[model samples]
Target chain A: MYKFLTTFLPKPLANIAMALWYFLLIIMNLYCGIAFAQGTFQYVGW
Target chain B: MRLLIEAILFAIPMILLAWTLPKKYVLLSQIIITALFIAYQSPLSFAILGTITFGNYYLLHKAVLRKSIKFVISLGILVLLIVSAKILFTIHDHWIIPLGMSYYIFRNIHYTIESYNGRIQNESLLFYLAYNFFLPVLIIGPINRYPEFIRDWQRRRVNSEYFSLGFQRILYGFSKIMIIGSYILSLKLSAIISNIDESKHWLKVYLETITVVLNAYFQFAGYSDIAIGISLLLGFRVMENFNFPFLASNMQEFWSKYHMSLTSFCRDYIYTPLASYFRRPMLGVFITMIIIALWHEITLPFLIWGSLQAFGIYLAFIFKDTPTSLVSKNLGRVFVFNYFCLSCVIIDYELAEALDIYKTLFFIN
Candidate 1:
């Protein structure tokens, strides 16, 4: 799927875009973790 | 959570100072910053870390030069510290687990073991303190090895590309924690799971299991990303803790991708040594997982979770030699994912409660 999405772009551009995609994915996870920790919500394991 | 906020507030000024200061003073500034940060967390934390830094330095100093019983004695002292700390945390309600105790203990042990085998040669007191108390990964860590961390520190670089990418990673981590982790799972799935006895819906049980897995991933990997990003901003490189673990097709692959640092640490420090000592890979695997499990928490459920994980790993190892069709591979992926989810549920709940949910999922209740 990733290959298909990047097939059209030049190699460098594709690499950069892939990097950005991964970056955002991590940021999203980090944001959720922080918010969860700060919130008064109950969670399972620490 | 408050620790994280305090870390950031504490780090900003130190970061600026390190960035603007003369090169020779950077290490000293980092040491001071780390000392102050740990002190701010708790005076006890400050004293504890100070003691640990000085103690490990002295022990490793003596241990690294030997190939005799004294080496054993030195290693024993370090292990004793970890074991006593774990025991004290369990038996005493008043014991605060000394900020970063788990992380730095593993780190000190790693250093001791690595240095014993001639993997690291540095004996610098300043570098040792700075490496272990590195503000970014001090609390939650990717667990950088002493040599690798020092190597990065010595040749630190702060280019615009690294700066932008580092900030980008930090933001991505925050998004994972605040948005996907909280909104998608904590608020919804946790609420549903807490009320599962009343619901008794198989689908909700399944969803809860899935959310448990996702929440664990986001929470851990998110912290790792933030840690790695902050390390990058500081012009030091910390190892990546997670890959795209959920996409992994088997337990072995999953273990390798998930918590890469800890897994590798166990592999290198525990599994390899024990396997050689005992001449049995399976025994080594079992012992390693047991240690890993116990490392997470001193509880019955964690032990069970570790046993389950070790079982999964053993199963994967057995199946590695078997030829599988594409269908089998897909089935394996599903099986592995579900197995992990169920085991995670076990970790979160009492055995009876967990089994009840499992029975409902199987339509037996």
Candidate 2:
């Protein structure tokens, strides 16, 4: 699946696309971290 | 969580300073910063860590020059400290946190072993303290080796690409922890697994088992990612911990992929030596897994889980010689995943209770 996606998109373009996805992930994580910090965001390990 | 805040508020400025500081002063600055962080956490803990650092340093410093029985004696002392700390601190008992005791002990032991083998070149007390207590990796470590860490410290960089990538990695790790690990896994799914007896349906049982196992993975992997990312930002190239472990096609591949550093540590430090001594890789594999398991938590359930893991790995080793087909490959993936999921019950439950859960998972109850 990853190979197919990369094959369809050019190398540099694919890199950009992946980087954008990570950027979105960062935004989502930041929102979650702040919103859930007071509620459910507890680390699950020692 | 408070530690995370402390890191952002306090450690980041020091990291930036250390990055821009002269090469010679960088290590000293980091050492002082890390020491202050530990001291701020607790003065007693700081004292304990200081004693450990001095003891390990003195022993290693002496052993290399003397070439006498100090090596064995130092190793024995470190092992004793580890055992005592393990017994003293249990999360369930709430006796003492033993803040970073496990990680620092292992780090010092690694330093001691490498020193005994003459693998380490610089035996500077400051560098040793800095490496062992490097504030970022101290909490959840990829267990960076002393030699590798020092090498990175000497030639650390702060290029645009590295800084950008490091920032992205940190964000990614935080996302994994906040979104998936804590919210989805812990809040939503683990709540169900904690009440497993409420469900009689096989599907629910399977779902709970898989959720619990994934919870364990995400929790640890998320922390590891954050630790590694933090280290990267601090201009250290710590080892990778997890590598798409859930996608592993076999148990051998799983171990090689999951917690790669710990696996390699076991391989290099424990398995290789034991295999050489016993002249059998199989026994070495069992012993290594048992040691790793007991190291996590000294209990009967962990022992059983470790044995199951060893068995899975052995099967993978045996199957490697056989002719492969796509069906067999997929089957191998299923077996490995299911084995790990089943074994993870030991993390939270006792032997009998975990066995009951297994029976439910198999629809035998």
Candidate 3:
């Protein structure tokens, strides 16, 4: 399994060994979006 | 208003699917999509959608596994569809563009093509529809290869983490669409560009060209983000269509960053073969670019847009074997990127006035 993980990923991305790494940063930022939005629709953009 | 309502309806089903059964849900999801398109009062397009779905489905089966004939006949049929439905928009001049036609059409034929190439395992009808008509990425797509997309679909088993991850993607998408995209859209870059006087501040043309490219990316990315976000809320994962594309250092990289799925589709289906046939890399790039332009619309501006990129990419390919590697690649990237943006600026002009606007670029008078 370790060998498989090393081979499957690009060297730069190998640190994110879990299968879900592609989405980790995105998930963190989503909470940031809600915090930024604070329920305001007018100037809050989208 | 209508866009907002449609957006809501779009997100609702995918969320439910994630909650219920993520992997198998595309089966249900596709059925809903076909039904929704019909309800959208574009029932006429049902023929177009249904025909493409079944046509490729049957043709690929016969051509590949059955070995009824080589791939030529199937390829020919797809080309004919492209010409009539996509190109002519109907010889009648009164036909409507099919709903979600381009994405689905491309998906259908592409699936068949890959299957024929032995790149994919046999997919069930359920997976097929989900791939073709998956609502999250339907209108705009980060088009998934059958193998990659299906793997993701089948493997998905929703849990709290999945919900949170999906929500995150959706929220991020909404931020791009509702906020930044709105501002870029409101700028109406083309309108501003058109009004600028040729005599003074003439650099406006270049500025406008740059602006048009930015606006287009934002608008497209914004919509894609919304799609991504909504699907997330529903606990489904849709691949992203855009990365930080403008940051792309070269035409090749730009494509990888921007509208990635479409670019990959074109590359797989069009570019590589053309390159191989010509035995001169430039020819393939040029021809492939034209196909990309034609996909945008059968118009001169779009053709020019596609042509310029092809020409630039061809130049880069020439530089591939050159000694001044880094500099040549960088120069080629800027040239293609600028040309791509400028061509879009011309495309932004009114169809009737496009020629005149183009003339203005040269004369500046």
Q: Write down the lDDT of every candidate, Cα atoms only.
A: 0.80, 0.78, 0.63
So what's the TM-score on candidate 2? 0.90
Best by lDDT: 1
Which candidate would rank higher by TM-score, 1 or 2? 2
Residue-level lDDT tens digits of model 1 in B99-209: 888888888888877777787877788788888778988887888889988888777866776687678678767666666676667786677677767565787778877
- Overall local distance difference test of candidate 2: 0.78
First chain TM-score, candidate 2: 0.67
Better of 1 and 3 by lDDT: 1
User: Candidate 3, which segments miss by more than 4 Å at Cα?
Assistant: A1-46, B1-4, B21-26, B62-65, B68-73, B90-94, B159-162, B184-199, B203-205, B231-237, B318-337, B351-363
Write the residue-wise lDDT of candidate 3 on B21-137 in tens digits: 644445686567545754574777766676776677666664344543535666677677766776667345587676666676677667767876787785577667666766666
Quick one: RMSD of model 1?
Answer: 3.8
List the pairs of residues colliding in candidate 3.
Answer: A45-B178, A45-B179, A46-B178, A46-B179, B15-B234, B166-B232, B170-B229, B173-B225
Segments in model 2 whose C-alpha atoms lie over 4 Å from true places: A1-7, A10-19, A38-46, B62-65, B90-92, B188-200
Docking verdict class for candidate 1: acceptable
* By TM-score: ranked, best first: 2, 1, 3
